[model samples]
Target: MFVNKAYRFRLYPNKKQEVLIAKTIGCSRFVFNRFLSLWNESYQTTGKGLSFNFCSSQLTQLKKELEWLKEVDSHALQSSLKNLADSFDRYFKKQNEAPRFKNKRNNVQSYTTNIEKKNQNPEVSIAENRLKLPKLGWIRFANCREVKGRILNATIRKSPSGRYFVSLLVETEVKEIPKTASTVGIDVGLKDFAILSNGKVYKNPKFFRALEEKLAKAQRILSRRQRLAIQQKRPLSEAKNVQKQRIKVARIHEQVVHARTNYLQKISTEIIKNHDIIGIEDLQVSNMIKNRKLAKAISEVSWSEFRTMLEYKAKWYGRQVIAVDPRHTSQKCHSCGHTAKENRQTQAAFICVSCGHSENADINASRNIHELAILL
Candidate 1:
């Protein structure tokens, strides 16, 4: 079956390429913001925003008038306009909040450019450790895996920790695996990352908490540097010591993110490969986070990220993932269908008052989720 997928890799650009990339990112952001302003002005004055075609046509004039804009990839500029248009469309549909202007200080820089298909030349290709883009030419990247199929577009981004990455969107086909009879349910928690219906538990790595002390120390040093800079009447951005400490703090957070992502990817792949049908709670994480007491633990566990990984991996592996209602999964007795506050004897134990049944709380929840999935 055909599947649209994205593969991301770290980029190692030379000094000249880095300059060009920075220019391209800046120009893309400028074009997007400028057009957004025009769109708003037109909407207020004429009750309608500029059409995509109209915006593109104006961009041609803009590039001609602004010589610096001509130095970057023209396709990237156009893509910026398309992104703004798409964002506004989503806003109108109430699917997302309105788009905001991109700020350089935000510490996240990115631009998207599409690969053109021509009769004589392919727009994108990979050779060894190099990747060819529209205007950037061959740039070195860590080729962790071979990219297959037609390349549609790519988004290049620079993180706060001064790392560059490129996400390549590709159109490819994947063969579905043979059906398996095995099925399982999962209950996610803070003590353990996940508890399976079959009584297996995946321990929470707690990456952030593990690095919290180091992070706090780095931040404290950064704060001291900032205070010194302020006393000297200089902007924090211009303070050398402050900048160095900021990077130190950022790297710690980056490590945490990488560790969590790696763990989720590994566990999700294992679950998808082992089971044909996977059931999980349909957790309202946003509402759940409102409870300030549990928010930190919830965020650290990264349940949303885990669920997202499971869903996408399930599709790729030819497995089924079902979201069961979370209402009484923890409180309900799996053996007798009795559900009440008294059923949960403690955080870790469940003893059904009506049926006198006993089980691990998380395991019981997983069993209830499994039954719900089977019914669904």
Candidate 2:
């Protein structure tokens, strides 16, 4: 089987290379915004926006008019226009919000460049501790693992935490794992990260909550620095202290994200390794977050991320993941097939009103999901 996979690695660039990276990202952003503006203007004037081909052809003239644009990778500039075209297509199809101009401050700093193909192989290559891109030469990177297969494209991005990384999209042949003998059901919650039908519970790490104090302190310092910059009538970007504080704040948030991702990946891998069929509730997280009382807890739990990890890992491991309807899964009595609101006696307890069956609420819900998955 053929599969497309992405691997990300930390990049260490020299001063000159760093400057070039910033210029490339800036040029890509400028190109995207310019094309978006032209698309909107043309649509309002002629009732039709420019197509990808039209915009791509026009980019040649744009590069000639702006010498700074030529300093960056040409393919990366074309990819920016392609991104804008995709955004517009999604907006027209009602799949997403309309395309907006990229802002230097809030927008993500990244650009994509596709690898040229030769003899059915990509031109990009990785050496001992370096990876080569189109315009940017070989860059030193942390060699965590070997990259396999044909490199299709690469996206280089600078995180808000002021860390540079690159994600390589590669196409490879898939090898499935041996089938497992076990199946399991999972119930996810804010209190516990997950409760399994097999009576195992993974405690919620609450990574954000754990680091909230540090983050709040950093934000306070950042706010104070911003105020000082305003008092001095200088641009906030020109203020060294403000920039330093901003990075500090960003680092705290990045720590939280990294912690959560690590925790989720470990548990998801464990589940996929143990089970051939994994059943989980089809949670409507967006609707659930509407509860103001639980929004923070729900968001911190990141059920969506957990589910996404399970799904992709299942596919990679040659397992099956089933999402069962969550309605009344907790209230239903797993022992007697009795379902009622009163069956859930409390937050953590489930007792059937009809059959007097009792069990842990989350465990019972997970069992119901498992049964439902089997029936489906």
Candidate 3:
């Protein structure tokens, strides 16, 4: 079996190339926002949303209306905006929800569409290895990894840590591989990010909690500096100091993301490496956060991120990730197959009222997940 994968490459460029890349990203963002504004207006009047094709066509026409865009690259501009339209379409379809706003395209991320035929001139084989774009021309990109197979599509986006990445969808020949292990289920919690079917528990390090104290201090400092600069009615140059402080705050957020992402990858990789099938509950995190007392801790743990990490990792490792309904996972008794509300006495204790079997709440939930994976 084959899969669609995203590989991040770190770009290294001189000052000039960096400026060009930034400008190109800006142009793409501008187009996205413009389309979003126009689409929203259209929706307001017609009570119907603009189709993906509609937005893409308008975006292409609008670009020609921009004189400066003539110098950059038309292909890149259309590709980026078309990507925005495609993403919104996918989001609405996947979530069974409606799109109402055009998302803000930040930095380093642009999109190209996947038409019927593949791009014969692969990214690796692009002119000057810079990848020519409309208006932007051939801007530099990271070539750390080569693109293989027929390129179906590509998306470039920036992380909060200010890094550029590309996700590629390619058509490849299916390669048969022997299965190494059996299927398993996973339970995720705030206390321990994951509990596996094999009785393995991953402790929630609370990486954000560790840096909370320092983060609070930095935010206070940043706020004070920001207010002082504003009260002084300082010139644009004075704002530079405030900007520096803001960057410091951004760096802290970046650190938190890096640490969390790394931890999730390591844990998910280990799980996928050992199991051919992985099952986890389809938790309603939004509802769970309604608990006022647990909201802070729940957000800190980031269960959703863990699940997302598990999904792609499992795919990469040739494992199946199953998301069972979250309802009653904790209350269900693995021993007697009794699922009742009374089975769970407290947050950490599980005692089946029907079967009289007692166990750790998390463990019982993990077992239930495992059973569900097998059944699925």
Candidate 4:
């Protein structure tokens, strides 16, 4: 079956190409913010937002008026409008909050542009260590893996540390892996990343916690630099020392993110490869994070991201990922079906008050999840 996949790579552009990239990113942000303002005003006056076609026509006229907008790739500007329309659609559907204006001061910036398919040889093609983008010509990239499938579009991003990257979305056929015909349930927790019904536990690496002290030190230095810039009446963006310190702080956070993502990817891949049906708790992480005491720990655990990885990986492997109701999963006795708060004697141990059943709390919870999935 055909699946849409994104392949990301580190981009290394020349000075000229970098300038063009910056211009494209700025123009794209400007277009998005301009139309977003218009959308809000239109909705206030007419009880409706501007249509995509209307915005597109306005962009055409805007380009004519502002010649600088014509300097970058026109497709990128159009993509900005499309993104604005999508934001409004999502807002109307209550999928997300209303769209906000793009900020120039944001550490990360990105712009999307589509590939023209009129010619056999498209502008957005990957070759020996280089990716050719619209208007930016051929820029070298870290070709870590062979890119496969038909390229659709590319999203170019400038990271907080001033590094450039590109994500190429492509359509490709993926074959399901041979299943093990085994079923398993997963209980996710702060102590362990995941506890399986088979009594196996994946330890939480706590990448952020491990580096929290170092990150705090870097951030403190960054704050000092920002204060110095302000004392000298210089903009933080123009202050070289402040910018350098900011990049240092950003790199620390980036390291934590990379480590966490890698760990989650490996764990998710391993689970998807071994199981035919996987049951997990439907955790409302957003609501759970409202507890200020556990908010940092919860965010560090990244339960939502792990679940997302499991779901997509399961789909790719033709496996079933069922999310069962989490209520009483931990408190219920797996062996005797005795449900009570007293059953969970502690965070790590479970003992049934009535039936005298005993087990690891997480493992018992996972077993309950497994039983629920089967019943469902």
- lDDT by residue for model 3 (86-166), tens: 666787679545444434433225544342244454433344355533233355676666665665655555554455555
Query: 1-376 in candidate 4: lDDT tens per residue?
Result: 8899999999999999889999999999999999999988988999988999999999999999999999999899999999989988998899999889889888789899998676667878778898899999899999999888888899999999989999999898889999798999999999998999999999999999999999999989988889888999998889998989888888898999989999999999999999999999999999999999999999998999999999998888799999999999999999889899999999998989998988899999999999998887
- Report lDDT per candidate: 0.92, 0.90, 0.70, 0.92
RMSD of each: 1.2, 1.6, 4.4, 1.4
Q: Give per-residue lDDT, candidate 3, residue 153.
A: 59
Model 2 lDDT per residue over 33-95, tens place? 988999999999999999999999899998889898999888899899889999989999999
Whichever of 1 and 4 has more TM-score, that candidate is: 1
In order of appearance, the predictions have TM-scores of: 0.97, 0.96, 0.77, 0.96
Pairs that clash in candidate 4: none
Error of 4 at 324 (Å): 0.9
Compared with the true structure, model 2 gives a TM-score of: 0.96
Off by over 4 Å in 3: 35-65, 87-120, 123-177, 235-238, 312-318, 337-358
- Residue 365's lDDT in candidate 3: 94
Model 4 gets an lDDT of: 0.92
Between which residue pairs do clashes occur in model 1?
none
**Cα deviation of 6, candidate 3, in Å:** 1.2
User: Candidate 2, which segments miss by more than 4 Å at Cα?
Assistant: 120-123
